[model samples]
Target: MRRGIGLAAVLVIGCGGGSEPGGIVPLSEEPAYAVVLSDYTSTAIAMVRADGTAVDERWVTSGTETPGLVAALSGDVAIPSAGLGDGTLWLLDRFRTDVLTRIEVPSGEVLGQVRTHDAGEGESGWSSNPHDVALIADDLAWISRFEPNLDPAAPELERGNDLYAIDPSTMTRRGMRIGLSQYDVEVAGADGTSATAFARPSSIVRLGDVLVVGLARLTVAFDGAGPGAIAEVTIATGETRLIELEGLHDCARVVPAGERAIVGCAGFGDMAGKRATAGIAVVELVDGHVEITRTLRFGDDEQLPVASQGVVHVDADRVLAFEWGAFDPATPDRLFEIDLATGSAVEIASSAGPFELGSPLFDGAEDLALVPDASRGLRRFVRGEDGTWSEMDAIELATDLALPVRHIARL
Candidate 1:
């Protein structure tokens, strides 16, 4: 049986007509929508029109004992379709907990939840660290687990570093598993313990019948990473192939860009080494084969200084990305409008401090982009009549929790 909690219904006026008790509520009558925001520990959702107007900030909140949506300890909001609208949402309660909670939008109801991994002895015994989900249909979905089990006697379902097929509606596994252990590399820990590094699958994006998964390939001790790779899994047959990027490490974010996909690779190692290996890879499916057509490397004199914390494709030739500035305290993180064709970038906005910005969400219909910042709230950027993007005033949540915005998904 599925586990869930019941919460009081909160009415949202003016967006659409009211629904009967326990019925599906229409979020909006138009294409205008809302975004669900997470702060690792909790979440808050808000509605915004196509014109960039904030409709409601407290449509749903994690302020009560049994909140409609919850992120246990350290977790994130996982929506199958980040750029597109989907009424379904998944909460990944990672860290010490290996649970995946399914939520219904508008109603803010917890439909059901499932433990993604097996529990051993104590609290820190084991965790699969479920990262991202790719929904193929109403009953079919795939979740990528980031941590690999070191125990040689672990069960197949308990093994991490792979994708597990599940039914989204029931929040249960469908008895099929796609393992990526073939991509593991050897590494040593700080205690000098040598073990095979995990593929550490993070983000997943669906392209036709194939699912493109990004592998972080971090060491056993989590202190370093190897050359990142992309695993292409055939949805119908469960066949898989790994494509390793020569210089990139920790390529964990993948976004759809027209016929191609943009991968954000945060390189590994010390400060200088991280910058040298960090870059972006533009990939596309050609003749049934996944190929990396272009790459934009950081650390070069002309390239961007650091790796990207978030990236969103604006068009076929351009992408909006924010740099990771934690390596250097003197440099604040900046959002850039990068030109893929020319290998050039234009600074559009900057954060107050390092590591404040999170993955961005863009609505082409609204021509609006949202970047979540820990200190600045939710930042908005709008494209003007002259085709130039400009920053607008940030949207502040009315909640008193003081949680930083970590992840966002369009409603």
Candidate 2:
């Protein structure tokens, strides 16, 4: 029950300062052992085993599109294969997860790769639906293209998104509009009609050269609710800005704790009275802009109504959001346990949501946390030292057995 929506400041980009702590292994394949599921529609790419054990029934990178999200980088595993569904961005092999190599991102090059709506690169008007993939440096890589582009004549409205800068030593793709779908801008002031031109990029996080993206907007009038923003790109100088949030709207995951920014909103559920922005958005980046500070909701609108999905961060103040209830297993999916210093939040752990596919992956050893829960297939929680969180054994992947998942990484 807290919705600030403040900050339009702008002025803090002296040079950029906050992205320099690396530890996902980087190259000898230590992304926490292994657990990369993205059977978006199914084609293979399961690989469980860090304790969850599924042992590769078919890690087939991609051959029929639909791989969705995954980017564990180091010795491999960069799968973004959502070419809107035609799929293609796989880089696999993060320690024998099957061989796949493709990052030649070409079709329209970049404008959001508009092939035809979701594959937008040929006949369709807008598509840039890339969604998730990041490395920051170590050869450089970052991908996220899912924004604005709504125009069904007037379905609330949205028309923006595109941010790619992958070199992978030279796989290619340099298209950054910063955050990409700012539309006309002027949130809070409502000057731009009332807001809601939307800005939908979903997840991305980096602090040093700036980067910080995680958005999902809708505010002005739709009843279903919408409001979530944080787009601060400056990777070498794409120089963009936008920080407007309120409880958050659709974001899904934007990890990175020390410098702040742990959004995982998805709200938009129980709209009886209509005010669903969902929860969590603690952002940062002061002086120049970007400041949501804190939002974490669900104190009891009835509880168990969030939408979050796969977030990490676990230290600096804790984080582990993941509650993908949309597939509705009765619509409760848990695993919250936030604490950004003091904003509080509990739930501890619980997922088997029935379908949208639970999502959280950390397990760098010690504190542990890795779930893929499709009825409890690859779960594992273990925190305790003083902090708390339990529930360990889970491993039943026959290639997602029943299927329907669509994202989960940490190889």
Candidate 3:
């Protein structure tokens, strides 16, 4: 069940590794633009024109420093609001950002803000760490939690998951606590001695009726206890299945093509270990069973690890992947066009700086938006008719969200 596409051997493109002496192509393309919550101290959600111009920037004046952590662009609308999964749009007090502000999506009216009594131990905290949000149809919001509330020495608190069934029309929080569990890890690869590891809830994808979940795996020594296998939980039935692998870090949303899912595997540790595996791994979905298909690596140095952050299926034969800059700062953050047809990949374009790319989003309609790092914000790039690349000029949008802008979804 393992398809090995082998390697095309692309030379590792390091940061600041440029070919033309003139420097990055001057951005000329201008497209539609919009910014969400731009008035705040930091910018979070934004909409850009097909030509690279930012349309508008709206700064959700949530008093919290990191408002865009779970923000999204409402369906078919340019406004960036915090609502998804069951139609629950999130509203924070403009005066007090940490307060749970609720707002209805349909009419843009404010509902009562959520209030909480201190639960003592792991209950009340200074900050709210809402990891990922999934839109269930348009009624329920499935919000994941990864609270880094513990100091380095203190034992990590019992982390739980929340599923909010918000009334789309009223924007009220419903079905708040769905499930809770200990922090989990993902498996990327395994050898006889030790397996590579990843941490919990790195990425989540909704597939078919069930949500295919991917977490970071902590590849520990086989001799002792380590991360459990990667698992999937059924939202409807609450059934969980472990799709075991050896090492894993982050995973992009499932690409719906035929029945296969293309998962990007980064190297071993936080680039801490001496050895690592950098490539793209594939999983097949059949009869509700998850199976590993094939792993494709870019370029020759298999050791040069490709930390794929995002992937999208363009066609049966072609797919797009984002390669975060590895090891060297000069390594260009690369956009790889993978050809399953030849088991080969090509570097279509790259930002020479270490633009630590967040997950990539393809409107599929035309434009592409990529967030670099959790704190640095986002930069919009557009492809032109001539096939050359450039930045958008008209619409100026901010990418950094103070807190890391880890994920982005097209609503």
Candidate 4:
């Protein structure tokens, strides 16, 4: 039930072997490729030749309407399907169409289907609002869950923010609660509520043995007027440490140069307000200790604050950041290259102009992929010699690919 792109949108992205001046340089050497899953309509998964030739298009899932997220590592692609309102969870084998498994986190059972429901309701159920998934080791799956916002304005019963370290071999759930504390609350708003009581964690990234979780601390409720920071939780011991900040959103990666972890804090005061003083925070993660070394802000501070929704740290020195024009998923996006050594940001590529870039795939310093809006499929990007970015062939994916891409890892 996947809809192919219309002739008009295809032409805008240079279909029929056409060319444009500001176009991404065509990919010269084909590499492994796949399409990001958007919800249950089974998007696309494909392999591309080094010179940008489409090798195949396969459907990874069969369910429609249920959005899924894809995470590919080694030789396996992990696809987690979102449940409706009954606490049911679905996991699909993206490479093989016949391989699919579903589980209920709360009940620990292999049911045909489970329902996803709001947290504050009468019946008890686990929220399948799966935001991100990562495969830390063979048999171990780390799933990040964003609890459903019952009150888009002001949620009364806030109970569900968690990270599960599941052993895929046993189907057992090893879970931990991920949250933050706000110390910067104004006196007028303070009411004996500790900062840790109402912290909302957004994303999580696992670097080796350390799991770095992004926390949006609340300075105020509903409005999301709060200080932002990243919490580093050790996977082995489960001990957590918080990196505090005034305004922040997402965190990036652990650079290997000084063995530092780079985080992107959304510096926007409100959804539409101007950028503030804080930018990307580079902290050193050694052994199991986390310390902030520098804060890269925009302008004289020579730092460009990273907009949330998309960010990738390829290495210590080079990082890929997505500058979101608006909070809307449909809003246009831009990619910036941040240099950690000098603490500066330079716009490298953009999807708003010629091609629309959705979730980006950063293979390394020279490789990246931009999933064009469902209309056009996935476009691969590989850095060229002249400080330019080029595109390869369109990605082929499973006809049943059912998830939006949460993150990408090259096999």
Clashes of each: 0, 15, 68, 47
Q: Quickly count the clashes in candidate 4.
A: 47
Model 3's alpha-carbon lDDT is: 0.41
Kindly provide the TM-score of model 3 when superposed on the true structure, using C-alpha atoms. 0.60
lDDT of 3 by residue, 325-381 (tens): 655646757776676556666665565455555455454456454433333355555
lDDT of 1 by residue, 242-279 (tens): 88888878888887877778888888878787788888
Candidate 2: where are CA atoms >4 Å away? 1-44, 47-56, 60-83, 89-170, 173-212, 215-229, 232-239, 244-376, 379-395, 398-411
Residue pairs with colliding backbones in model 1 are none
TM-score of 4: 0.60
Candidate No. with top TM-score: 1
* Ranking 1 against 4 by TM-score, winner: 1
lDDT of 2 by residue, 72-164 (tens): 222233343211122223443322222223421221111111111223233245444555656665345666655445555522212335555
Error of 2 at 343 (Å): 14
| Highest lDDT model number | 1
Error of 3 at 128 (Å): 6.0
> Where does model 1 exceed 4 Å of error?
1-40, 47-56, 63-86, 120-124, 188-195, 300-303
